[model samples]
Structure formats: structure tokens, C-alpha cells
Target: MPYFAVLYDYAPGSDPLREHHRAAHRAYLNETDHGTVAVVATGPWSDGEPGALLVVSAPGPGELHAMLDRDPFRLHGAVAQRRIRSWTPVTGPWA
Candidate 1:
């Protein structure tokens, strides 16, 4: 499995909706384990940015894409912008 870093910016005023679907999102992350689809890290960004970052292990690009497609926030328009990138670590824990 390859590592990937995903960042998604939430829509303005979508906090309520995100709160409503928070449980579901967390649940999906917990249950969507396919050995390779491991969510290694996740958290929100500070500085008035309504967004989150997730570092995960995925088998391929399409697998990651499908995972995001199934995310409640993305499906519900809470995610206004995103940047997903493949990571190759040489000195970090993953390395």
C-alpha cells in the first residue's frame, strides 16, 4: 500500500451539517478497513479554516478516490475544496 495525504476544506457555515454527520464519518473510517485502507492520522486545521487532514494507506489512486467519494461531507457538499496527494516519505515514521 502507498501513503496518501488528503486535505478538504469545509464550506462556509457548514459546521452544523458536519456536526450532524460527524458520527457517520467516523464510523466509516473505522469500518472501511481493507488492510490497506488504514487511516493513520486525521484532524481539523486551526486558524479559522473549516477543514480536515487525513493521512492514509491506500493500494492505489482510484482506491483513495473511491474512499473520498463515499465520505459524507463530500457527498453532502460540506467539502468545498480538496487537495489529495500521494506521499513518499524518506525520513518520517512511515519511512
Candidate 2:
């Protein structure tokens, strides 16, 4: 398995929609069967930005993207963009 650093950029002025679907979103994250994918860490940006970062493990980018597509936030149009990149944690707890 490989790891990926996923960044979710929220759509402009979609706060209300995000709030409306927040519980569902969290539930999805907590309860979904991601198959080979494993969510390592996930949370919203605390720097006054409307976005989130999720570090996960999957077989590849395609599978990761497919899994993310099921996210409540993404399905409900709360996310404007998603950036996925390969990540290698050579040190720290993740290493």
C-alpha cells in the first residue's frame, strides 16, 4: 500500500452547505468501508481557511480518488477542488 496526502479545497460560500452536511460527512469518514484504503489523519484547516487535509493509504491514486468521491462533502458540492499527491513519511510517528 502507498500513502497519499489529500487536500480538499471548499467551494466559495459553501459554508452553509458544509454545515448542513457536516454530520453526514463525519459519519461517512468514520464508518465507510474504504476497502484497501485507510484514513490516517483527517481534519479541516485551522488557519481560517475553508478546506481540509486527509492523509490516507490506498493502492493507488485511482482508488483513492474513487473512495474520496463518496465523501458527503464532495457529493454535495462542498468541495471545489481536490489535490492528491504521493507522500513518504521518512520520520516522525507516521514513519
Candidate 3:
């Protein structure tokens, strides 16, 4: 499996939608299969931007995208942009 760093940019003024779907979103992440696509770490950015960063392990980008597509936030258009990049950890807990 390969690791990926995913960045999600929330849509402008979509806080209501995100709040409404937050439970389902968390549940989805919690219920994901470890062998398939494990969510290593995830959290919202504390900066001025309204977005989140997620480190996940999966077979590839296609599989990761498929899994993410099922998230409530993505389904309800709370996520305006998504950036996926391959990650190789050298000297961290993930390594």
C-alpha cells in the first residue's frame, strides 16, 4: 500500500452543510477498512483557510478517491477542492 497526503478545501459558506453532515462524515472515516484504505491521521487546518488535511494509506489514488467520494462532506458539496499527492515518510511515526 502507498500513503497519500490529501488536502480538502471547503466550499465558501458551506459551514452549515458541513455541520449538518459532520456526524456522518466522522462515522464514515471511523468505519473505513484498514486493509483497504486506512485513515492514518486527519484534522481541520487551524489557519485562516477552511480546509482539512488527511494522511491515508491505500492501493492507489483511484481507490483513495473512490473511498473519499463516499464521505458525507464530499457528497454534500462541502468540499470545494481536493489535492492528492504521494507521500513518503522518512523519519516520523508513520515511517
Which candidate comes out best when scored by TM-score? 2
Q: Give per-residue CA lDDT, model 1, range 1-95, as digits (tens).
A: 78999999899999998999998887877775644577888888877678999998898878788877888888888889888899987897899
Stretches > 4 Å off in candidate 2: none
Ranking by TM-score: 2, 3, 1
Deviation in angstroms for 45 in model 2? 0.7
Q: Over the stretch 25-87, how does candidate 2's per-residue lDDT look in tens digits?
A: 988888648888888899999998989999998899988988999999999999999999999
Candidate 1 lands at a TM-score of: 0.87
TM-score of each: 0.87, 0.95, 0.94
Shift in Å, residue 46, candidate 2: 0.7
Superior candidate under lDDT, 2 versus 3: 2
Worst 10 residues of 1 by lDDT: 28-37
Model 3 clash pairs are none
Write candidate 3's Cα lDDT for 1-95 as tens digits.
Answer: 78999999999999999999999898888885744899988889987789999999999988899999988999999999999999999887888
**Which segments of model 3 are wrong by more than 4 Å?**
none
In model 2, the clashing pairs are none
